[model samples]
Target: MPVSRTERLLNLLIALLNTRYGLGRGDLREKVYHDTSGNDVAFGRMFERDKNDLRRMGFEVETLTDTGWAEDDSTTTRYRIGKDSNRLPEVQFGPEEWTVLLLASQLWERAALGTAARSAVRKLQSSGSLAAVELPAGVQPRIKPAGQAFDDLVAAMHARHPVAFTYLAGSTGREELRTIEPWGLGSRFGQWYLMGYDRARQAPRHFRLSRFTSAVTTLDKDTYTPPPGFNIREELDTLPELPLRTAVVRVRKGRLLALRRRAADGKGVPPAPAEETDDGGYDTLGLPFRDPEVLAEEIASYGPDAVAVAPGELVAAVRRRLRAAAEFSASPKPRYEFPGAGAGARSTGKGTSEDQLQRMLQLVPFLVHNQGLRIEEVASHFGISRRQLESDLHILICSGLPGGYPDDLLDIQWEDGRVYISQDLDLTRPVRFTVEEASALLTGVETLRGLPGVAGGGALEAVALKLSAAAGEEGRRAAALSGPPVTPVTPAAADMHGTVRDAIAGGRQLRLTYLSPQRDSLTVRDVDPVRLYSQDDVWYFEAYCHLVQGTRNFRLDRVQELEPNGREVSATVPAAGGSPDRLFTPNNGDTTVTVQLTRQGRGLAEDYYAERVAELPDGGMVVDIRFGNTAWLPMFVAQHGGTARILAPDELGDAARHWIADALAKYDG
Candidate 1:
């Protein structure tokens, strides 16, 4: 019978690792393959593939081509894996550094990098010298990778592959096809942007992830190599932020109060007298805008209640979005699936040999350091099933030196409920971190710098230096590939985080001087600290307020001042809800608004925890969202421009129309 692939690979690894002089193709075929490769051609192909696989797993398999210096030399080429290079160097870190490293590991959250970050951490933990450290309660920070698009883009970037997608242009409000050699991805101004070489444009361009009209399609790996020393962080520095400009908008008197307050002066006017329009009295305000698209969206959602009067671009954009939203409201709603309803189409999380090999390489060392662990516990740590772990243990028990003797193989036993690795065949150490592994970790840590009070002051830099030394050249390359460059929280904000962390840890009450934008007021209140976390790089704390007597979320930046109120928290605070994805908690009396999201606005479905009521044919979604108030629905529909419209609840739809109509009536001569 033909030999199993597991046995063949294990045998091949044994032959290569045990060889003093490099083994030639003939010797490898005879000793490792044992004629199971069918023929000479098959043997050669198998050997080449196996060599590449080992190299991909971070094993340095050296190839030496004979130079005909010896008269009796018959071997043309031979291969051998360097033992020292395959084994990881000793890694040591103090408690402070470990605290920061642990913090970095959690940054990826559920993003694709989370897996690599976790694996990298596991390898570090297997070093047998761990210092116990814990990050403070309620001080969790995470990177939000929106959906499948982020995973695909990050994968393509790592592989150096070119990607094709339909991108929606902001300036013209048009969709166009783009082929990009992705250099890096980062967030600026609360949005993710891809910096890449546009193949058609033949120049570098940045594309927003939300504007991608179609799913990203990866072309080929190694399509083009990025320039050496290309730093994603530095490249982002050259790009200018959206320039602020002013827009003249006419508002229905006393209506669109939010928009009016945005540009209001002391007298509630922009030095222009109020005039009566066909609908109601109108007041024109000089509204400052950084992006016409955003401004247009906000105006259009107001329907007839607000209108842009000046800056032809803003006026036209606002009109276009309002018209589209009005039209969509008149159309039939489509069907949509709930978030997890379509999960069957996703991957089953099966591990390939390539994946399994990497895990096992790390697993061996982890088991060496941590002996007598439960089989299930080991499987859980490695992120595999107990059945898969058993299969791996079986394969490992049969792997070792070329002789195939009992002592020649590894001695692994788990028949007694707990697993023990008595013999490891000199594979007791983890391998060096691969480029991809090191890159994900370094990028995560780099992002932590943007978080205030994370990495605990000096620990971040010291850990970074030590990780660079441990990761060596791979770490240097990782430095070139960067994630989003989030602006560091202000020094005051950092101090605020430190104070909030202490309060939450101590279960103390805090007196906060806060500015409430909704109320347009500055007030001081005593709030019992509960949890502190961040979503989208914005820090917020949930606390029970003495005035409101309910838990309310306070944005860190909005706080004018914060000090402990010198009292232990009275109320029994619930454990901080782990994830901060949804900052606003909905009330029972809130209305459930069904809305249709198309193109750019589709992200709102996830942002608001919308239930998939329907799906649209134009690659859009119809969802039902429970908003604390229907008052904000008009702004929501318009802010997404034409991409979102109120689908159900007739009165809410009428509100959108009336708001737009009043705004447009002001534009009439």
Candidate 2:
């Protein structure tokens, strides 16, 4: 079997560490680098390269020459890693510092930094430096999930290899093959983007990973290099701006409150009507958006709570989508295949070998610090199988400096199921965070700080200072350049946040006086806390609701008053059913309403109400949709600007007409 480069490096490191007296070139070639035993020059070059790599990783490789007895008159040379100088200095973290480090580690929960963070945490845990502090359940911040191409692209970026993939163009909706020299990857507004030099376009281009239509294939040839001083963040900031259009929309009371906050400036538009809904619940506001399609999707997601009021073209576009959805829903699965519909790119497991090398590098240092750890304990601590640990140990034992001899390999002991590293070659130190890793952690911490009640504390500041120090000058600069901008939190929201977090941490149920936007009413309920999380700057509490008799998500902004119930949480709260995206599902009590849509509204029927649509011979469609409450249905129909009409359920039409008449009454008045 052919040995891998990782195995070869492991063997060399072990050989160098085990020898008290260094072995000569011939011994290294024959014993350690046996594959190159016949080629003296190749072995010499490989040995030199290995030594340079180790030195670059902070190891000090030393060479010594000794003259044999006068009879022989021959000089023998040897090399070994300088143990004293290469050993990492002992450093301890205070409790607060440890907590901050843990927070930083948790920031990389799902990104490319995951492996490094996990290894770092394990080392810290094994050293007993972070034993006492527990990470809060609610503070595990996650960035938007990256596409399957993420790992491959990161590897290609590191290796300076060009990559080829089929991408769906956002502008034309056409699929095209693209080859690019990937410089860097970054996240903005919870989306991963690749900043690269497009070989075909012959210009720098940024592509969203979600736009990729095929698996990323790295070319075997390493062809391009990124320009010096190129910054991903700077490139993102310089991207061309989209033209904004002001849109008049009628919003249900308390719905889309965040958007209301964002649009407070009015942008020179006329003041919005103060007219409330028929039940005195809705508010009409003018908002600005750059992309009508994206805005349409967002507005549609609001169900009946929002309606497009003006910009006839925008209303038509939304109506067309809603009609398409309705038409598609009525069809019994037969019908047309939409363009650009295909299975998503499948994630590849090609990064395992690279991850293993990283794990070994970090594992050695941890083993050195915590000797006599059971194999199971070590394996569990590193989050790997025992078999994998044993395999790594096998590789380490056979590894050493270029001179391949019995005494040149690493000295590893796994006696009675406990692991011990007798000789570490002074490589027993966790690798420092790369600039990107440090920047990512810093960005996550910054986002956390912006969350309600998270900042304005000495602990967070101390954590930031320690992170900046550990990241070094390069990391500090990168973090400062790329981190997300902070958004200020309201005082009331901050206070409420502290109370909710405290309740969650203590396993206490909370009595909350919450305003229900859908019902347009204020109600009190007892909720057993599960976790508090944020999506798009809005915080929500996922809890077991005593009123609903099931899990529910309550927006923090809508929480009027919160008080601990003084009762311990007795029942186990089940994990949230789905992510925030699918937080709401139609229940048994929702009313189903059928509607008739004209041919122009077919798009809306197919796209928005597909699950309940039925196609008609006249190129029109009928859709049956379920609503928990009919309060916003009238505005939703009015948003279509009359392309769709209620066909069945006269009560729903009556409610919608009444709401629209009231809105028109206010506007005409």
Clashes of each: 17, 53
Give the per-residue lDDT of model 2 (tens digit) for 1-669: 767777876666656666788766667666777765376567668778878766644456778677543422213677776455544334466665566666555545443555545554554454343446645555433433343366567667755789999876767756799999988777565456788899988998888765565568899576676787777777777766556667777777766765565466556554655545545466877787765555765565454566777776556455544554444333342232222223111111224444666678878877888889899988877766798899888877766656546665567899999988887765666655554455555555655565443434476767666666655643443432233332324677667667777887777889999877556677899999777665334567778899988777788878878999899775667543322222244568877777666554544442332335555666555666666666666656655544465655877666655554544443334
TM-score of 2: 0.59
Highest lDDT against the true fold, candidate: 1
Q: Tell me each candidate's RMSD, in Å, in order.
A: 6.6, 12.1
| Candidate 2, number of clashes | 53
| Residue 71 Cα positional deviation in candidate 1, in Å, after optimal superposition | 20
Give candidate 1's root-mean-square deviation (CA, Å): 6.6
Q: What are the lDDT figures for the candidates, one per model?
A: 0.72, 0.62
Please, what are the lDDT tens digits per residue for candidate 1 over residues 1-669? 566676677677767777878888777777667775457677667777887887877888887676754423426677788888876578788887887787777667654577788878888988784687756577767677755577677778877789999976877767899999988887766667788898898998988775665667889744888777777778777778876677787776656555555675333323443444534466777777766766776777666667787788788777766666666655666656544764321221234687766777777888898889888889887766788789888888877776778988888999678998888877777888877678778887777775655556588888888788888877877754555533335688778888998898888889998877455477899998877767656778888888877778898987888999899988566656443434466667778887777644555665566644455566566777887668767766666556678866989988876665555455544
